[model samples]
Target: MSEGNHSSVTEFILTGFPGLHPEYYGLTSAVLFFVYFLTVVGNATVLFLFATNRSLHKPMYYIILNLSVCDILFSTTTLPKIISKYWFHSGAISFTACFIQMYFVHCLGTVNSFILFLMALDRYMAICHPLRYPNVLTNSTILILSISAWTIASALCSRLVIVAYPLPYCASNIINHCYCDHIGITMLACTDRAPYGFPAFLTAMVTLLGPLAFIIFSYICIIVAVSKTAHSQGCLKSLSTCSTQLIIISLYYLPRCFVYLASNVGITFNADVRIVVIMLYSLAPPMINPLIYCLRAKDMRESFLKQFRRITIPKKGQVSALKKS
Candidate 1:
């Protein structure tokens, strides 16, 4: 081993699911395909609805659009590799591919976290300080915040690629998860700890816990304000909105924190268990987020159904003309 310089890792073997048991490979492929398919469709629906519907042109929906983009990016960052792992019965990823996956996955994950915080704060302003909501969450401010959120997430999480690349992995090149992730890469490091560890830790805290705290605090104020509101209908509406956002935040963060933070806690000792947890962390949120929005949001529900019907129902004049022709 060289003293100061490090050799680049040529490739990484992903050991998630033991390379998909021969008997179960078909089942695994089917299941993962379905999940990835739904994730794409669901997030795409959100993007389309928000884009086409002029009524959804508010700062809140603008934020939702940003979140949808993040979700789509999040799913994209890992799902293809997951599919390849399952279908090909090969889990080997090139070092370059691994780094790219890790970078984008963390970037999207952090963006989602900050966007959720922004969402909670939006709700807080709308509910707890309605009079000041418009001025505070203006279009310009929302754009600035959204841009800042992506930039910060990308900058913060980029260190994983920077530090993890130089680590020696002569002993083992196998990553114990399907998708490239922090833990998977960290395990490849010959040293138990490295420059990667602290940077990864700091990025996780900044991207995960910091935004989580902001969301929780914002929702607390939102709930209290809702409780004090005199109008029952208004209170119900506010509660519904806050509850929906809370559920999404939970879906996004809880699994992530469990898998990432538990690395040090000894709870994620089993590699198989860790892989399962990480897969859920990757697949579940994108699946659930659009459902939550469509179910809880009346406008979204109406627009979705309206668009659905518009595509399905044939025009009466067109039908008659076709019959005549």
Candidate 2:
């Protein structure tokens, strides 16, 4: 064992899906890679829509742009290494790299939570207090909120990494998960973890539960406001908007709360089940969020249709040129 704030283990081997059979490695890796592809493509398309389309330059889509960026970044930070691990049989990550991965993983997760909070806030203002929403949620406001989410997440998550980094690790270097995380890394320390683990757990809970409480409250208010509207079509339209956000929220938050709470309360989940739940919460929203936006948001749908026709159909000058050629 080393003397001062140093670990004897230099690197870690990521054991992705402990129960995955040897023969199924290729299948699992292929599936994950495809998912990663979808996640990137979907989020990227949303970003492109925001950049090129002037109509999406409003506050809600601004927050959505933040969400898309967060999802793409979160997926990129955590997925590639594991993909390499399964596809190329390369899971050995250095201790420093592991901690860095943990920081981004936790930090971006918190940012995603904050972005979701902003999304709900936008809805709350627009529906519950329609008159003031125009002044309240502008581009500058979204930018400030987005920047604050990133700054706060970075500041808070840095503590988790800093506190855990100095722990003495004279034990096994095998991390029993897909990627390095505070829990997976800190649990390996050769010292009593209560001093460090509890704080990390509390931080995790704060990041998840805080935004969730607000989201619930906002939606409750939204529901009440919608119910009071005399126009049935207007009520349905507002609900339709909220339904997509709720679906994305449910996908992102439910499994995560269950896992975090269950862990704290000593409810044991199967290792494979836990990992699958984690992956579902982490990966599923990013991939499907853009689809939800396009399918549900009339503006986004119309924008895409407009783009599609512009691309597939040619201008008159181009048609004349083609005929001449």
Candidate 3:
């Protein structure tokens, strides 16, 4: 077996957007940096809320926490290099490091899909089988399932790296995308890309469509259950509770599915447009998810308020001592 060291290319240049004018590099970098910042702060806040608030220790919140972590990790994996590339004219990435980035990028994305599936399953149980939910999905069970998702995703993503690393690269080392993904890097190989490309595509389909199918079915069941409610208000409330998640799910999945299908099905799209769409689905979810949670979840809002007050408001004794001082 030829090792990665045998490959001619030692590094790769990440072409963030093929059509982006050089003059816009600064602006592009600023936008991406802001996105990265928001993603980190927003998702980190969710983690903080989950960590500090005991009231959030439930099956539903477990999924929220897992999703937040996945979002943060995915953003971290894909955003910084692009930001650096545009900001400092530093697009070079070591071959090994590129593969490492690709691994995390795909792994975390898969984990997010599975976590969303869990969220859908939790809602399904709550709405469709309310009586059995208490016995079915406990905190411990969710934890195990979460760990299994991460483990399986990690294992699956490693295959892409394994298959792509050893291919011979004659000369071309430029990757015409924002990151070193399976498609971007493997396409540069001198040999036939079929062996690596097909399996990777198959894996991507399985990882994305598999969970997405369940999520759709679960929501369908949820809608049916909500529709059967006797009062209109009850139906509205049930649908309202799901609206936030549905928005997030659509943001993450729809664009991705479109891009993948468009590329595979001979539907032509501009390369720059494709990259922008990829960035949106990859980064937007992480940045906006916390806002959705804050708006939709009363308990989380209250907890955030409580935490803010605990930090901002002083004790009476301390206030009096400060006045004396």
Off by over 4 Å in 3: 1-7, 315-325
Question: Tens-digit lDDT track for model 2 on 1-325?
Answer: 2336554688899998999988888888899899999999988988888888999999989888988999999999989999898889999999889999999999999999999999999999999999999999989999999999999999999998888887888889998888999878987889998887888889889999999999999999999999999999999999988998998899988998898778767799799989988988898898898888877877787888988788867776688899999
lDDT of 3: 0.88
Top-down lDDT ranking = 2, 3, 1
Lowest summed-lDDT stretch of 10 residues in model 1?
Answer: 1-10
TM-score of each: 0.91, 0.95, 0.95
- Clash count per candidate: 0, 0, 0
Give the range of the ten consecutive residues with the poorest summed lDDT in model 3.
1-10
Top-lDDT candidate index: 2
The models' CA-based lDDT, in order, is 0.80, 0.90, 0.88
What is candidate 1's CA lDDT for residue 19? 35
**What tens digits encode model 3's per-residue C-alpha lDDT throughout 1-325?**
4655445777899989999999999999999999999989988998999899999888998899998889888888989999999999999999889999999988998999899889889989988999999999999999999999999999999887887777787678999899888888887888887767777888888888998999999999999889888999989988998988999889888998887777666798788888988988888889999888876888888889998888767776688899999
* lDDT by residue for model 1 (194-295), tens: 456766776787778998998888888877888888899988977877776776678778888877677755564666676787777667878888888887
Error of 1 at 47 (Å): 1.7
Candidate 1 clash pair list = none
